[model samples]
Target: MRADRLVSLVLLLRQHGRLSATALARELEVSTRTVLRDIEALSAAGVPVYAERGRHGGFVLLPGFRTELTGLNPDEALALLVAGSRRGAQAFGLGSALASAMLKVVDALPESYRATAAGAAERLLIDPETDLLSRRLAAEEVPDAIAAEVLRAVFAGHKLRIHYAAAADASPEWRTVDPIGLVTVRDRGYLLATRSGADRTYRLSRILAAEELPEPAQRPDRVDLDRAWQERSTRFRSGGDQVTVLLRLDPARREELAGTALAVHAEKRDTDGWLRMEASFQDGRHAVWALWQLGLAAEALDPPWLRTALHDRATALATRYGTPS
Candidate 1:
């Protein structure tokens, strides 16, 4: 591990000519003390590394020092750089590996195109957590050790024993499943697997623990994960406890309603110029949450339960605010 780390340290310095101890530690995912020790190690190993003191000063390597590794063209290097900026790799416990690989990619770029490619990559953003509306899009947290074990099982073609909690408050249940693939959508990781020959997808965040079994998994030699994921998604959307609701929506908010619903069964314009929609949602809770987001712009007409839920929530909020100080 130290050998790998030392090599990574050298690669890091070789990639970015100058970086502060703090900066290096941040990039290395280590502490400053560890970084200092590494610098000494590098120096002892004859790495032409040195330090400069004062503000705007940091560790620097001798000029013209280079590694033999090379050969990414401008477009290839730019593509790698752009891909490296994404956060999905972290979900699979490959964040450090990705960082080291990106550094190597940058270090390998022909100087003629290195800076230009990096600059171009910097101008492009991929799968940013937030949108133009400024709403925070948070990723679910998955423990690295658990994710790593799951990844190991997936790659090794072994059955995985998982302690999974179907809901936040539920007790974890142990299950041995043959992992088919891993899929991430909207930053949430899911493990696609079969338990007792039944398709089951478990959220990575809800996995309390994971153990890779010695027995080889019962899975196909090759899988089309993309197609598998799409089919699973289609089944999920169509098989849930669906609640159909008639909604009177503002024309401007029609798209928002459609976006939140499982399906917009029908849409028509009322004489009053309001958009009427028959929409199906996954469940009662989903319907409530979706309609709540529209405030007064959307009204749940047919579903008495949905209307009652909205009214209750509104009344509770009003009562809370209306109470005497």
Candidate 2:
């Protein structure tokens, strides 16, 4: 939808020659802040749009420049179609709008490329629900009413009050935050905000309720969401209680062990062909669970407590089956 709005901004400038941010916002039916952000995006993308400082002066596009669907190459057009087909757009409540935009795109393209591009895009699959191993990648569901409140708050730059359940065992509690933006990673939606000047990220699915406050959000006018997400992700990964364990694993299952570990500190093949490895996990429980899956194929060497726990579990299992219950 932002893409469509940006294109409309360009078209308006091309048709009307010059328009103030307020005027553009009025025409586009959005806030002047949104219009300003769009203008910045356009400039960054190398569109020849400039502003004049005088009271009467506004934003103007350079003379003799034209925008048409022909500007997009076959690959570019196909890429757009493929992206439109993804479920990410739907996460932001823009699925139908994106579908409409894609239809317009196909209609605008030359007949020769239109059918070919559409057909090619249909042939390609992006982000299928089930992966190669037949495992379903469940998309976290956020109620439409909750998502709508958050969206309105993000766009309006207002403080947000949310009843959030921090954990499954904990009851939902109300908290107020200054919202920065919404981020979706692997089909999971997150609201990036600041609470009492400290960064916070909340899962959309966990929000029991949301209310947009009338007060303006205490946040910067501009934000680099990608950078923000990276910083938070780094801190989250490095923070928390980490557990390290040394193990002996079947060479074939070494990869499987490493895949679930937070970090694989070291690994080597033993003379007997087993893999001697040191791995770290989010917690001791995480380490235990990952290693338990391999059964006899994986052995925890270090951490006497972990080895004892696994031994106890295996003994209990063997005893259960050794004689009829």
Give all candidates' CA lDDT scores.
0.83, 0.82
lDDT of 2: 0.82
RMSD of 2: 14.1
Report the lDDT tens digits of candidate 2 across residue range 228-306.
9999987876789987899999998877887788778898899999989988889889888998998889999989999
- After superposing candidate 2 on the true structure, give the runs of residues whose Cα lies further than 4 Å from its correct spot: 1-85, 250-259, 268-275
> Evaluated with TM-score, which candidate comes out highest?
1
* Cα misplacement distance, residue 172 of candidate 2 (Å): 0.6
Error of 1 at 26 (Å): 0.7
Model 1 whole-model lDDT (C-alpha atoms): 0.83
Query: Which sections of candidate 1 miss by over 4 Å?
Result: 69-85, 132-134, 268-274, 319-324
Q: For every model in order, what is the number of clashing pairs?
A: 0, 0
lDDT of 1 by residue, 139-242 (tens): 78888799889988998999999999999899999989999988777677889999888888999999999999999999999999999888887898788698
